[model samples]
Target: MSSTELQDRNVAWFTERPDDSQLSADARHLLESYSRIPADDVVEHVIKVRNQAWTIFPYPCIGQFRFLDMSMKYTKEYPELLERLAKGQRLLDMACCFGQEIRQLVADGAPPENIFGCDLREEYVELGYQLFRDHDRLKSRFLTADIFDESSPLVKLQGTFDVVYTGSFFHLFDYANQVKVSTAVAKLLRPEKGSMILGRQIGAVNAATHDHKTNPTGKMYRHNPGSFQEMWKKIGEDLGVSFSVDATLHELARDHFRFHTDDTRRIHFVIRRE
Candidate 1:
């Protein structure tokens, strides 16, 4: 659909439109091939017909529907995070889906050059960078990197950031993978000086034991946030990192989006090195 249509429906409004008139012959060929389908068909095909696209859209990707409101709520509740940015702290936006946090931080006075965002899906990252690259407020860089891949571009990076943030990415993996990711994040930070904020989905039960829900394409993923925290703590111990529970959003607010399960609640934690 058109950008206006997506925006009206509360979806990620595509700000970058490939200009057919400006394209060279090769570029035009690619554009024609890619945009062959009607706008509405493109949206429906990706959002409903494709499996991976289904999981990434309108949900964790924050591509549409009340995402902007939730982004504002998170920064509002965690003023400390914003204050840290004012102090020249470098920030890492890990698993940053649509780069809303990066945009928000820059808008809130963060030096864009000091901020970096990484996501596994290049499509999302490329779209974000293209749409947000020209903002006068941000000097930050966005990269398409996989957090779970040890040898991915994210792992190859050299410097430690003052703040590393991930929103609702931890619960997507299994317990063992969660532990691995927690340890990796710790290792990426400097001991004691680095702070990590996680917007997590927690359940009262272990994630593995919870009912498996299928995406539109039938891929089963775990959504146990409570058991997640307990297992994550043990994982931190094993990795020699000390993480503390910072805050919890008890699902009492209707403004919060349903990330995993409609019954699922949230926990926000600020972790530091032991």
Candidate 2:
């Protein structure tokens, strides 16, 4: 899709270049600490990498450097995830643009071999290597697949992961598509107590489908905590399993941006199979 068309979905696409002040401190830390970009050149490095990824896909997250946020750090489950990864338990990062969180896991002492990252586009994965400057060091495997496709590589890896992390994902789909993705995620995780799916997404006080600017005919779901739980519960029932959903919707200091509105809230969720 044209940049002009993508802009409507989120105002950041093709907008005027934002100043360095717009980059978050956490993102800066990752660039300096994990990527080893000199503190002085971090902004320049981020800009160079972001520019390359945008040419591949004008995702709002890419334009805003939201991918660098390492969302799992803020969740209550963060410490637990770190513990799980350190012990050789498997984890998968879905829609892990630039593989930022995977790098964070490595930086935090998790074994790279225990973690996996996947996205729909492989270009983002290539750019991720550039962004982190870790092509030679990081051993985490990155896969590219469509979550909704039954024949997709991600879908084929059912029951292999213990923790599935999706950063700024799920909100990109309509209700039906969201259900499909959730079902796929359910299967992707080990079907035992404590196997979990967790992530951050664009949420709303009111749950509903909204217009998708990148795809004119497409719809994206903005869910509240209740709606999100209901979705997984319905899926669990159909799959003959049970789930424990812990979700909360709240605003963040970062929400005051071109990509969000008053209705926007951060949905932090963890769904564990029981």
Candidate 3:
């Protein structure tokens, strides 16, 4: 294909064309039972929104409907997490795409106003509304801004949240940016005991930087449990706080993507402010 063709299609990142197989049962339940989408039309509506989001960024997660993969319920802390949210503690779904998890939480009794979603693209933020078909009723707030931008609107939200659910985030950058991302997350967290961060991301048995599929020199960091904890330990000391990091890796890349990476695993983690 010509460079123009590839550029226009973003074939490098948009290789996978997903169908119903990529959609999860929980997602279907949320759409049908919660969002009130007709059962017959749920798949079509999801495909349409996924394609619309594809135009913004051809992320593997979006194409595979990984955004719909709810990581909250699987966590060991889920019961308490939902309980606290229902009791008025707020949460930020950092890098939330289509706010699927947010909808699930709301469906499971967490207050919609207690949930906040932030994404770098306003289009994705708006797409969440379209995907859930709840613009008129869902009370969750979605912010469209980059966390790295010093003057971004997210700055106004620093230190206000009790929990952050950030699935498939943080491994997207190199070490420096990973620290920056963690720092940004930490800044958003309430600096008190019980402030917590939970979610999953790609990890490697050996911490390293992997080549980006789309860019010649772009790299993303993958961490082992030890390295991840060490980074957070330093961050805690630097910021005069303490933390406990629980991370583990077992699931392989092939389980989620067509392309497989050796030693890559899904790291499930919970970091708590202590």
Using lDDT, give the best candidate's number.
3
Which tens-of-lDDT digit does each residue in 4-63 have in candidate 1? 332332333221221222222332232234234444343333333223333344342233
**Candidate 3 lDDT by residue in tens digits, 133-221:** 88999999988888789999889989999999888879778888888889889989987898999988888889988876532226778
What are the C-alpha RMSDs, in order, of all predicted structures? Answer: 10.9, 2.4, 2.6
Clashing pairs in 2: none
Lowest summed-lDDT stretch of 10 residues in model 1?
14-23
Q: How many residue pairs clash in each candidate?
A: 12, 0, 0
Q: Write the per-residue lDDT of candidate 2 for residues 99-192, one digit (tens) a residue.
A: 9888888888889999999999999999999988999999999999988777888766899999999888888788987888788888998878
* Candidate 1 vs 3: which has more lDDT: 3
Better of 1 and 2 by TM-score: 2
Cα-based RMSD of candidate 2: 2.4
Residue runs of model 3 more than 4 Å from their true location after superposition: 1-21, 214-217, 253-257
Candidate-wise lDDT, in order: 0.51, 0.81, 0.82
Better of 2 and 3 by lDDT: 3
Write down the TM-score of every candidate.
0.64, 0.92, 0.92
What is the lDDT, from 0 to 100, of the residue 202 in candidate 2? 81
The TM-score, computed over Cα atoms with residue i paired to residue i, of candidate 2 is 0.92
lDDT of 1: 0.51
Error of 2 at 105 (Å): 0.8
